[model samples]
Target: MNANVTAGEAPPRAGRREWIGLVVLALPTLLLSLDISVLNLALPHLSAALGATSTEQLWIVDIYGFMIAGFLLTWGTLGDRIGRRKLLLIGAACFGAASVAAAYASSPEMLIAARALLGVSGATLMPSLLALISNMFKDPKQQGLAIGVWMSCFMGGMAIGPVVGGALLGSFWWGSVFLIGLPVMLPLLILGPVLLPEYKAPEAGRLDLLSALLSLATLLPVVYSVKTIAAEGVGAKAIVALLAGIAFGVAFVVRQRRLEHPLLDLGLFRNRALRAALGVALLASATMGGITLLVSIYLQQVAGLSPLAAGLWLVPSFVLAIIGNMAAPGLAARINPAFVIAGGLLVTTVGLLLLTQANSPGGIPVLVAGYAIAFAGTSPLGVLSTQLVVGSAPPEKAGAASALSETNGELGIAFGVAVLGSLSTAVYQSRMTDAVPSGVPGTAAEGARDSLPAAADAATSVPADLGTQLLDAARDAFAGSLHVVAVVAAVAMVLYAILAVVLLREVAPAGGAEPDAEAGPDSRAGVQEDAAARR
Candidate 1:
């Protein structure tokens, strides 16, 4: 009788049916992140083949991210109002076609244009997948685990993309990376509509066209401005662009507050768990995204490892990341999330601290150990915070909830690059100024340093002592800057731990109601009650 009752009580969980759904859903996340990672390894080939100049190379690498970041909120909200599967189908088609264009492009400009289109298509799928996953998993433990697994795939794609790209580049041409996604995506396109159930926005109001435009206006410039600052320097032009972005961003926020049906319901921030989780996510992003790029440089440039070898070094960190991520739900089930999050921050800080000590000679081992420890700490933080944000939001606001989580993530990435990445460049330039005896002018030095891979290549042809001086200066400068970045990350993680404690409620055990399904402002009776109490 008890068994029958338990079977009857099963709350429409994602059965074998939804497992298939998850595989399809994971495709875009994999591809989007894959595209982002593959380009770094492929940049040399792209430049050589297409005659891509420095600025053009930056565009080729960054346009995809900017377009996706700019359009994510708009697309996610639209999917909610329109229909996730419908948009997913449309996005898949556009993505596949753009992949073809990107693969075949003879010029960098054409490839950049194609990549931008791919970004637009990519933006639509992320929110749909998160929301679909939320709806499918009826059990809280499963919901948390599924989200973790989804996130693991995202990081895994980013981690392995270069390895795949390396193998491809060795075997084929520059376009192969762009072509790889097509076969994987084809199956998702065919099976998605037939298998995934249809879901409507809880309140599918007419599309908020103005708010969408405002989002694009604010986020695009801000993201672009930051990328520029990270790649170049904090010059007058970068500052001006950043100010303009901030101005538009303030305007966008004001407009959202005034609208009856805002593109995103910003009031969702009132939820304590949601807000705290966002804070944790932003800081985690800062640490992970900042270190990943910075360390990749350290691994390849300073440690003098091959592209393939550097990627291989990343395996330990990624493995630890997966383990750290999977541990979160289980830990949350037993303890207050405050302690759990604080513990994660503390653990990550230890790793960052170890990373900071890598400024010394023979520091590669320290770097790897630090990276592994920090990766373990951070791997779970993103997924756990994602769960919290969704848990805090009402189910109807899943679109908004997911978008907001991702916004923090992207912003964290942007800010990390701007702050930590800038510090690295500045330190490198300062230390290397007099160290290189090659008599290269400041302008020449800056230009040479712009593409470090090319610089390393250039070093091979110069006089032996001059080459050693240039390489050593570049190496030492990068190491010093990495130390600064590690310190900053450690500080941020420590601050985030304190905030998580003050803000997040004691996490209840896992056997309770699924957090993501009805945890938002639009769905949960508890949140509604809490609001009423506050009023």
Candidate 2:
């Protein structure tokens, strides 16, 4: 550890007030996650009400995520210059205002704009909350527990979002889904200043506008290109966009290396623990994201479940995810976190294998079982890996570090949906094309080959007997595609597990003491010094 720190001794424990503040901080996480899932369920209703074209519908959903991914680094580093609490409060206000605007939006363009604003505001919340947790809970064990609780809330939001959307859509309009954020944000904004402590980097300098622009340029094109490749397939435009993003990314890194006060510290990645933890987090998220997309499509399109029924079916997995997040810290307290992460990945691989058994419409139960096991296994990895990523960074750099972690998560989800989802779709289309009846009209046949949803729509325009044959063939082909994707996902999980074991072999448990002082102050002295100051 740095010469300024003490080792072996535990850091200060959070007081009752600090614990309560954690709950306050979690409100934004809950709302942000809820927004992501709820909108998917509301898409049908919103599409009809706003008279949205298919392209506009895609934009409405895609813009929010794209904006969030692009702005995370900017907001995270900005929080370090201006206090985390201050940035969080501002974000809360903007998020709440955007929600109201979204609820009342009358046109597709307006709704898309409102969702983009929500994404911009949301970028300010996640990193700030995570960094705050690091500052509040100084002890290694308590910090693990705190991060677990924070992650649990995020998972809980995802679990309940569909159910909440189902209920709202049943009774009111689709806009009511946006209203949910208002209640959550109201309390956070009211009590945040009264209860939450403020922290900022003491020696932080002026914000680098060029670096911020470069970061956005680097991330947005890559994400957009992946999305384009998924929807439209690989082409010259997508290839160029990808190359441009890589070029900008390289330039950003080089600029950071030369800057005295960089937006993201290049030195942080030098730590073996931090580097490995980030990699694990990214891969785990990608797997979970892909699995979620596949399951949602399978349940609704293949099994013919209504939105409400599908959401209800997903409840068990969500509950198990929460359980896994809560249990990870205690398990890691006894065993090394590396083993815990590796074991979780192994369990997830088994779950993926179980999904391969879902070969028919009646296999809904099998899908549910597989998803629950996979979600439970993967949830703990998220909590523990996130803890490792944040905890390994110096206290002053917590916001930037946390931002990097969250950015990786967004990218992982994007890649999962783009790559894995695309792979499944490609298989589905090829199989679907073969399954289409010989006498079907060209338009109907083309529509059926696009997707299950398109096939369902196309079925309505055809003769009753032909429609039945078409639907059956489409569902069967989709099921085959699902099986293929499951196998691919399982193989990916195995690789991730091996990587976790190899990379984190020497990483200690979350409950273990800090790194030894003899290792030198540059490694962990900043964290120990901050804890000492708080005490």
Candidate 3:
């Protein structure tokens, strides 16, 4: 059967092509994740090559996220109208092309432009991949295994990014890391056409060009506003940007619900399990995001560790996270995921609380231990919460549900950076004011302060006495920020724990989606068919 379709109709059954399609779909995820963290290691080379200022450097680091966050929903909807396989193949090509450009980017602006483009291309994969996975593994147990493997790979690349980057930096130029994605992407592009199934939307609806435009109008500004608040804090312009984002967002929502086939189905919020899953993803991310950033900073600034050393030392936590994530489903299958979530939160909260007591005059070991506990807490969160989210939705709405899951994570990161990250910057700047050399102007002092941890060693304009004073103050400010942020995150998690306990009362117990779990549904379907046979 030559199974293609008109604009929006039910896709032909994706028999035989299912497994291949899922693997092909996961390719873009690893490619972009690698590119993102690889740049962190490449920044020194980029700095020397581009002669970029600190603010310019911040732009380089941030613009990719801004692009990724804004376009996620846009591309997700685009796939449902067009063929998912077609877009997946197209996005892979774009990602490879972006890498080649980024590798040889002569200027900072050029590099940033390349990354933004990469973000646009990368957006195509999120919906297509989830939808493809849902179609491929309609049986819940198989789907659980598939999602676990996909998620493991996703986190694997993220966790290994720093380590891989360190190695690549030693052997290859900054651009070399970009070239690395090319080799990785080639097979996915080639195999994609042959192996992946094409998904056609079940309903025929206009692509709704106006709603698409409106989405960009609202999301881009809100995401950008959050990033701005992260870097610059809440001022008049930031306040205006935020308000503008909110107003547009409201209009966008109103427009969506009125549409025939909306870009995203907001009605999915009605599912208690789905809602709880997303809430946990967001809260957990806010806590984890804040802790991760603060720990990296603490290692470099307070403990005098190099980025490579700090990243290497942080390996234990990430490694433990892998085990924790892998073990969670099996555990959640046995015990209630809610209490498991609570236990994880309590452990993580204890870890964060341990950091407040870490303002000792001693050293870094205690801080590292605190981070390990915090990171360990995150492992279960990535798995159990996702199980609840993906497991909550019906077959057709998986992509939309998965998109919301991701949206929560992104929101977590944004809020973590805005609220907690800002607190850190403010405390660091205010407390460390006298730490700067009196000889340096206020503008320069402020500039130097804002770039802390990343450029701690290079904050060279201060006098020796002031240098020691500033360094100590910088550490204290960061610790204070860490203390405050951790408390905020911990409180949010604890509340989520209570919510999970109350809301997820009768969740599919452990292995609910496992092969064994699906037997009940299968048996029910068989009974109905047999009754029909008798009739």
Candidate 4:
């Protein structure tokens, strides 16, 4: 019973212990999501307090996500070898400790280091939580419900993170935002062993150190290269880093194919349904991440809203996203999942197109309406695509499938923030050069051109007329950048929509109708099992 291994039929309906344990799992899930967005409101405060440059600020905001994405596969596999609860408890402790360090960080470098540690620790939590949920609620309906609750908590946390952080920042220093993790984590560390069952794969293999290193090497360098290209344009350093990442990535794939017990099962990609689902998930995550950062800046700097007010403006979109998540399963059951996904993407395209028109301070309402539509539209992708990916894999490989899904999500968000943020930064800088008023001091002019926030700071040092000119130019430059990113993101959604229609067209409708005969044997069996479980 403690091992959570069931022989044939779905395990007995989850009892009281399983339900309580779910509450415990939600604790870390909430904290992890909050970490992703809490800093959006706190960024300006921290930047001012620590004198962080724009690049340093991006690193601070996104490095945690990058680290999490890099380490997820390693930790997910490791949990199978060791035990899920054990890993969760250990990670909770580490998360708590790292949060304290981040809270008291003396400089941007220190905060970034602490966040990286937080990311590594955070990686251990998700796979364990997800695998445990599947184990704890083996009945398909119960499992689905448990997952919905878990996702709701995560979505709610992300939605409310800014508001919560804004409240904290209003009353305390920026560091107070990090301390929110402490209260949630401490209780999990204490109650985890009592409430949560421990599960390890009976036939799990030894941890592959080299594959782990290769994954990290491949991911980090490529991400670095993308960020660099955006920051400094195409240069020797960017090219070398990109090439190194690609080479390492090739090696990682080759090694996975060769290994008896690979960290990742390269075979999973053969299932076209899973492949397309993950691709859609990654791009969607990236789009959402980039929008979150840009909108946060626009709310505070361009529209000149207070942090609390800005956070409030964001609440409706996230709430609607949670609604969309809740509705995706039923929608999929009613129609082919491909069309549902394509429809959602189309709605997202509409949202992005609306954002393209948001080029002035008066566009606040436009941004809000577009963001809500975009969030709600993309919500189905999160739930439905994850189901497709996991349902496309063999039961034994579910953990790996789940790991891949989670990794793509984390990495996509990081990529969005870095690449899109950099692109916007590039555009903003280019525009500011020709836009700043004459007679501004050199340092002040250079500062204004650096970023929107810097422009706000520089404006105070000059005469009102010149300062207004500088601020207006910065706002216009950023709005134009937003327009460009929106168009690009909308185009991406359209392409992915077409891809879903083509690639996922054969997938069984949600309530688990059997896949068409054209599906690979593995996918067919997986879908059959998923359907049986639901029944």
Candidate 5:
């Protein structure tokens, strides 16, 4: 009757030991998310210390994500073969070692290399941890709650990353930010094996090297293109990268279909609930990611708050998001998950609507309020969508399913930042060009139009009256752009809300039938058997 040894009969409900293991699994999820945002606050310090060129700075920030996205599929599948707990421990060791290297990196190139290594290691953690959760929590209700807790830790990490970074930067050096991962990871390395169950797919197939290469070829170019478009706009390089990614992607799909034992089971997408859940998660993450970028800029540039202050202001959103994440499972238990998702999206839409009213100089309160409401409302979808995706798949394929969930989330954020960030940048430039002072130097005007931070820097080199004019104009233009983006985000939420309702209407309640009742004969039977085993 051991929870970890469930075999013939129904999987037992998770007990105290499993719950403790859940906490251990959450450690890496939190650290990975924290790593994504922590560096943003320390960039200035690191840039100064390393004497990084603008291009190098971009690489330092981007290479980590590119590596993570590129390697997720390979690592996920590897986990299923090698053992999830084994991969998790291996990743933890690598992450810790990479963090130390990154912390003391003396040159820009070294830092970039360390970050890439960190990303590669980080890729192994997410899917392994999530799949472990699927193996640990047998009861659907407990599974829902555990996933909620897991997701909330991730959100919390992202939310507090800036604060942690700011506090560390204020007291220590930029290197300290990277070192923070060490302590979080240490406990995981020690406790993960002792408290957690090790699970892997039975008779998992060989690790296909070609499929791994194809996945990397497909994802790296696409992500790079998106980042380029965000930073440099549409160009020949971006177009080429995009096209190449698409070509490789098509090949990857064909390869997956042909392989007797593919790296990923493409058949999982045929499940309506799973497909829609991924769509919901993608759009939600996209919307939130774009808004997060805009909000951070707005706080620092337009509102003129310090990094620490802005981080403090964002605390409420994080707290509310935690509440919402925890509340979502219970809500889904009572109502249909589709209704819960739609309701959350609608709430986010309303919050976005509220954001549209924010204007320059005095908009901080409105912005904060709007962010809190939107984050709280949208938070539930992350937990619920992830649950549906992972829950729908057979337990043996949980690692692959979890990897897909993480991959989609990463893509959503990348695209969201690219598209919406570009939109806002265009609007800001247009507004700033017209509003620039009459006798300002061409260099100053160009710099000011690029971004509010650049504008503030440019202001310092001008006459007092000109500096005031330039700063005011830049802030106003940015605020105007924020309004436009908020409206666009609101519209997107509305559309996605409708899609969620229509697509997920038949999604079963927690502990009920499989989400994909209409799957293929083989998949349907496997899903049902898996569900029954858990019950």
Candidate 6:
């Protein structure tokens, strides 16, 4: 019996069948995230095998994500109009076929095309999986727990993807990495129909083609610009792309407001609870993405750890985060979810402050501990934020809501990398401006100021003492930059925590009744009552 159920009330509970169905849904979720990181370690072997040029290599690695972001909104609402289960199975079939094509492609162009196809197919999986979970798990408590498990699998896959790719590459060709998706997707296609329930909105009208194209136009160039800035710094190309995306974005918003059936359902943003949850997710993902990348580089360049060792050191943090993700839902069932989420953010702020104390070469232990603590605090945010975002929506709009959640995640990561990465580079250059040894060649001195990686290369050609001084100064500068990033992220986390508390305080515990005030604007209360009566 549900804790919130009254004497005569009976909320439908998820039982054995639903649990099994969750495992089925989890398959592609895991596989998609795994694909994101798996190709990284295979880059060298594949480049050698395919003779990929520098630009082709970038496309081969990046196109998967590019396509995923571009197609997310389209597939998200498509599932609501057609059916989530139907979309999931179709996506599984497409993903498996693309995996096979990628596994055997003889040329870089063929491989890139296969990867782009995989991304499109992959975008169909996340929204479908999440929306289907909404269909199967009606009770809020059960829904929260299910979402926790789902988030853990997604994060767990990312954590282990490089390890999985490395193991495959050790004994087999580069193509073996692509083949790994086959086993995962094949089972999903076979079991999905039998285990998963089908769901679609009854009143869902035809998808607006113009809105779909506008969304693509709005997202693709913006994502492209952000990524370009992160890679090559600010340029005219990035500026033009950014401006074009903003223009199209305004058009997309106008069309959505005027259309009978918008591709995205912009009205969903009017719900305060939904908006707050998404804001938390976006801010958290952005800060985490920026810090994660900087830490990886620090481990390798400043700490002088090998790639494998850096990866190994980060496992404990991921493991702790998974643990937190699994535990938060159960806790939230008893406490106010707002409090739980806010408390977790406070904990994360502590970890970020700890990170500011780390130094070069000797700060490995502090870095690892800080990262683990910070990530553990973050686990609750991911789990509950996703739950809140989905639950705040009307049942029929869940697909679009889920897509919005995911799209924010993608944009957050790109935005964080661009902004925080640029900040780090600027700080490093400022510190290194006059630190280069005077006798060094003009080219080496200029190169040393470019980046830490460039400094290492510059050191190789300079006199031994000069090289030592330059490398030491470069390492310290990068470490100091990390300090600045940690402080900035810490401040952002604090502000987000406050906003989550204020905006989400009306949200009920997973097992309890919603506040009467929320019933006024959102209609979530009526929907909950309807769901209860139906259950």
Give the TM-score comparing model 4 with the true structure, all chains together.
0.86
Looking at candidate 5, what is the lDDT of residue 123? 94
C-alpha TM-score for every candidate? 0.89, 0.95, 0.85, 0.86, 0.95, 0.94
Q: How close is candidate 6 to the true structure, as a TM-score?
A: 0.94
Candidate order by lDDT, decreasing, is 5, 2, 6, 4, 1, 3
Which residue pairs in candidate 3 collide? 333-510, 333-511
Clashing pairs in 5: none
Q: Candidate 2 has which clashing residue pairs, if any?
A: 1-520, 1-521, 2-520, 2-521
**lDDT: worst 10-residue window of model 1:** 1-10
Clashing pairs in 1: 325-380, 392-519, 393-519, 393-520, 393-521, 394-520, 394-521, 394-523
Could you tell me the TM-score of candidate 3?
0.85
Worst 10 residues of 5 by lDDT: 1-10
Q: lDDT for each of the candidates?
A: 0.75, 0.86, 0.68, 0.80, 0.87, 0.85
**Per-prediction CA RMSD (Å):** 4.9, 2.4, 6.4, 4.4, 3.0, 2.7
Ranking 3 against 6 by TM-score, winner: 6
Q: Candidate 2 overall Cα lDDT vs. reference?
A: 0.86
* Residue ranges of candidate 3 with Cα displaced over 4 Å: 1-26, 357-362, 426-459, 462-466, 510-535
Where does candidate 2 have its weakest 10-residue lDDT segment? 1-10
lDDT of 4 by residue, 275-381 (tens): 78898889888987888779878887889987778878888887888788777766776678888889999999999889888867799999988888887888778
Q: Candidate 1 at 82: error in angstroms?
A: 1.0
Off by over 4 Å in 1: 1-12, 359-362, 429-463, 511-535
Q: How displaced is residue 179 in candidate 2, in Å?
A: 1.9
Worst 10 residues of 3 by lDDT: 1-10
lDDT, candidate 3, 375-396, per-residue tens: 7776666776765665554444
